[model samples]
Structures are given as C-alpha cells and as structure tokens.
Target: MAGPRHVRPGPMVEAWLIEAMERYNEESLERREAYAAQVHLPGAVLQDLVWWALQALPDEILVGLDVDGSQAHQPDVEAAFAGEAHRDGLFAGQGFVISEAAVVNRGDSYSVHHLPEDWTDDLFRSDRGNRGGRFTHWLHTHPNAPAVPSGADADAAQETLGVDMILGLRFSPEGPLPWFDDVDGTRRTLAAPEQPRRFGRRGPPVLGVAPSGHRIHEIQLIAFHRTGLGVNVVLVDDEGWPYGWSQD
Candidate 1:
C-alpha cells in the first residue's frame, strides 16, 4: 500500500473485535476484573523492544496494534509491512486497522498505571513471541465510556512513539455508573441507526448488540499522535474494502 487509504481487519479478526469492547464492560466496576478476553498476534522484534502484543491479566488491556511502517514512523513515522500493500495501490497511511493485535498491562483503578521499570527490564527481555515489551503505538478500551481520550489516556500517550488509540464501548444496564456525553470533541461511530433519532447530535449512534446479551449503544474508535493531532482510523475488511462499504 503506497497511497493514503483505509485499514481493513480480516473477517476472523472482526468477529471478536466489537465483542472485545463489550467484554470491557463485563468487568465488575466494583473490583479489579480479569477476564480472559485475549488477542495474540505473531510479528517481528526490534533491537531491544518487542513488537508482538502478548496476553496479560491486567486491569486495562493495552492493545498494541501491529501497525505497518511503525519503525520508520517511530522517531516520527510508522513502517510499512511487506505484505500490507493494498490491491488498488492505496494504503492506510494515517492510522491502523485491527487485523491482529497483542495484549499488555493490568492494575487496580485506585493507583496510577505506569509501565514500571521492572516491567520494561524483565518483560522486554528476549522471549518466544516478544523480546522487550516496547511498542510504537498503543490502544486501550473504555468501558461504558465515550471514545474520547481522558486526562489519564492523554498522559499515557506521551510515552508512545507513533499514536495512541481509544476504543470506547457504551452499553445499557449501566449499573452504578451513568452514561456521560457532556464532554465534547469530534466523535466517530460505526454506523448510525436506521431509526429516526431525536438527538441534538448529527446522527444517532450505531448500536452493536453482542451475543453476550449486552445492549451495545455505541462503539467509538479514534487515534491521535502524542502531539494531540487526531489520526483517522478506517475499519476495513481483509480484502482492503471499507467495512460496510455501501450506502444502504
């Protein structure tokens, strides 16, 4: 892929992605929850840092998208993987597609989350799937929250090389926490509902109903460089076609 384009996830990967977001809410907000919703992707390594995302039982799952051209884009730009070229010669330049990923990090909500020095020293060592646990860019989920970056999320981005992404999943049966929409920024959703909406916003949000019986109200995905410049993320199929690429 050479020209600017979209990131497409293969069918297998898409099957569980939205569900992964839903799984975030399934965690009990009352305590630290460790649900085994893991994603494992096989990739390469760097001089000391590992590029692969691994499985960990952390409070938050830091999903490192196996971004293309991550190295070149590192000090500044991401590197293009050899087989990532698109059929039409158009490539996903601005952001990443969730074709494959790995998991990282976990902790209680009480204290601040940080990549501990021992974390990098021990986990980053040469291993089977990953070497050092370093990544160019990172993404995480916000259960029952909007996709907008929180103050903590922005603080985490400062440690990243390329960009940081947030996958926000909103659902019903909200429990003690209520849905908050007052915070403002550009919002991107999967598909607007077909029903006529009475909302003040431009469109009603796309509602993905997962088999888990959760009423998924909205799925938000966004990326931004550490500098705070917003990055565009295009959900695409394995064939490099935009997901739901049609006007219905």
Candidate 2:
C-alpha cells in the first residue's frame, strides 16, 4: 500500500499560512462569519494565500494572478502566483500587476486611485509581454466590514472579465460558543433558517450575534463577477486541510 503524499509549499507561503491559521482558529464567530461571506476559491492553495494576506496585513492588500486549470481542471486548480507582485499593497493605490516586479504607485486611500491612460497602457503592455498568463483574478481586503460588494467594487468588476474577491477582517476578544452535536443525534451543527422570520421588503440580517459577555471579531471573504456570478472561497492550510469554518 502506498503512503499519502506530502506536498510542501514555499517557506514564505508556509509561514504565512501557519500564522493566518493560528489567528483564524482563535477568532470569534462574528469574524468567521465575515470571512465566510467573501472568500472563495477553487483550491486550498489559493485559499491559504488569501487567508494569509488578509491576516498578515493591517490595511487593505491585493493579489493578482492567473488560473492554471479548467473546471475540467479537477480537484486541483493551480493558481499560478507567478508574477513578481503576486502580493502588493497595504498600499494607497490600485492597478493590475503587469510585470514580474511591478509596484503600484502610492496613492492616498483604501480605494484604488485612478491612473493615467498612458501609464496604464504601459503596464498592460508589460503584463502582456512578460507575464505568460492573463490577469484572471484580483483579491483585496476590507479592514472592518462585511465581504459584500460595495458600489465601487461593482463598478470595477464591470471593466474586467475576471472575478473580484474581498476579504473582510475585524478582530475582537469576544468569541462565540463552540460547536456541539445537535440534540437530535444527527451529529450536525445547527442550520441556518431557510425562510424569513419577519415580513419586510429587505431580508433580516444574516449575521449572528454573540452571547452576552462574549466578545467578537469579524472576518469574511466574498467573490463576485460583473455578470453576477458568485464564487465561494474555502480557507485551508498548506497541506490543503480546511480551517476555521466548514464547507458544509
């Protein structure tokens, strides 16, 4: 009988994953829910990268990359973080990474600042020439908010065919109750309600509350396309094990 294979991620990647998972495991339910709302990807590797970036940086960050597999691509989709700027920002500006080592010029806010037409053209050309893959996805962080798309996010998605991801992270000392088996003996945790409890045009808040005296933090990840497609991101460790939350 053959033994299970062990795949090793890079040193930096492994370090980041470990730190991110440590923080995630210690976070409160509100934080986990925030993470659940926005982060999704096709594989554990990508998810780990997203988680690491979200936890390590204090402000917003961005990662751009190309996909290396098909839906037929199977259980594994290789996210080739091949460009130099596989990670960028905690910066004041926004723009795609076009070269192996492109650095976004400094701007002044969480939102991506506008770039000159000529500068953008040059970067686009560089990306096309040096980076062998198309810029297929962009992941960013939201310091202390829900993972839901903002008006600006929506508008930006319209300009590209790629998916946009947001990771919402806010930390607090309070925590939620630990998961326990259901009384029904189903061995499952509680399920979310299927229908609204009250009658109103807008749906009730999907967010959950912590028990009295318990503190909370917020972490969420969500992805959307301009065409209205939503992607679910699952966080995992370097070895592809699920973390913090369950896929089910």
Candidate 3:
C-alpha cells in the first residue's frame, strides 16, 4: 500500500457533510427511531468514510467498505490508531472503513432491519442480479440501544467477508425504550457516556442535552468479524491516516 497523503476534508466537503448529517439526524429524531445513511469525502483517487462516521453523531452510523468490498475505500486511521503497531490501546485491529453508506428514505426502526418501508424490494434484487453479491460488509444502527448484537444480527453476519458493524445511539425523550446498562461486554464510544444519576436503586434517570438539542446519553460504535471477534475503529483523516499523525 502507498503512504498516506494525510489529506483532510476541504471546506466544501466539511460544510456539506455536516449540514447533511444534522438534517438527517434531526429527521430521524422527529420520527423517534432508526435512520440509515452513508458519508464520503472524495479524495483524488478514493472516497473517505471517516467524514461520514464523524458527522453522523448522537445517532447511529456504520462505516464499512464500498459495495464491492474495495480496499481503496477504507479509512487511513489504522496506522495512526495503532501507534505504528506498537500499542493500539483499546482500539486495535479494526478491519475496514466504509466505502460509502447506503442511505434509504426517512424512517424508523426499533432495530435497523425491522428496517423501514422505504427499504423496498429493490434494495435486495437489483435489475441485474442480487445486490448481495456487490457488498462484502454490512452495518446497521441501534437507536436507543447498545452496540451489542442481537441473535438475529449475528445470523445476518454469516454472509459478510470483511466484518459487520453496529452503531448505537442513546438519547432522550426516550419514549418507551429503557437504557440497558445491565449487559456485560466490551463497548467503544465516540464520546464518553454520561452515567445516569440514581436517587436510589430504582430512581428515575437524569439526562444531558447534546449539541443537537437532544438529551443525549451515549454514542457507541463496534465492529466484529463473522466468526465473532471484536474490531477496533478509529476515526481518521481522508488519506487513511489518523488526525493525530502529525502532532506526534
């Protein structure tokens, strides 16, 4: 692989993705459920997925490869993320970045594949053939839920050659969904989650407001191989390098 150019998003790309993410995220909140979409910043020879991962925050997002599972679309964070392969800290060994997201129309889902009505038949069977052959990776969102996989989600991973990712968002006006903190497993978050205050063992929760005006609680992103191993994710720059590469 060639060395990274270490490019960052230009002004136009920055403004566009930020505005788009805000609109899309707010639209999802208006319906009070899950939303799916992709983000990409065009580099000279490739499309960068980190811009998508960063912009779609306080909401669930999955960053994986393009439809063909192409390496050209991967993010440059791994090298910068791992400390030149010496110490990766908590985030290490991540498999892929997104090629681009597959966005559908505005919608809601308790889990993403309880997907929306707009995710109609054409998503599966294209005019040419099954669209499944075009993708090697997959990702989905878990609104008001943890990034952990459900039994159904595990079954869905059987087809992936790269890895599967889950993006979970927890925010307020929670409606009926309760924050599930009882589960045991490793989790990676974009922002450190604020713990709910308890008056006693069963106290009602107190939440905080996010920049988006939602009472945000947590943002989680996790990736796993089809065989059931964790993959670390690091948000990076356009050239497939982490943002901090030059700081050191």
Top-TM-score candidate index = 1
lDDT of candidate model 2 versus the reference:
0.36
Name model 2 segments beyond 4 Å from true. Answer: 1-58, 70-110, 113-134, 172-216, 236-248
Q: Which residue pairs collide in model 3, if any? A: 38-101, 64-97, 64-98, 65-99, 66-99, 76-240, 76-241
Candidate 3's residue-wise lDDT over 1-248, tens digit each?
11112232322333333332333333322322111212222321121233232234434443334431243324333322222223222221224344344532112332433333333355464432212433445566666677788776777566555567776666665655556666566665544224565556443332234434545445565666666755544333345433223444
Off by more than 4 A, model 1: 1-60, 68-99, 107-113, 116-119, 122-133, 191-206, 244-248
What order do you get sorting by TM-score, best first? 1, 3, 2
lDDT of 3 at 159: 56
| lDDT against the true structure, each candidate | 0.42, 0.36, 0.42
Q: TM-score winner between 1 and 3, please give it.
A: 1
* TM-score to true structure, per model: 0.54, 0.42, 0.52
lDDT of 2 by residue, 172-234 (tens): 321232322122210101112346566664423332323222122334555555565443344
Candidate 3 segments whose C-alpha is farther than 4 A from its true place: 1-97, 104-111, 114-131, 193-212
C-alpha RMSD by candidate, in order: 13.6, 15.2, 11.9
Candidate 3 least-lDDT 10 residues: 32-41
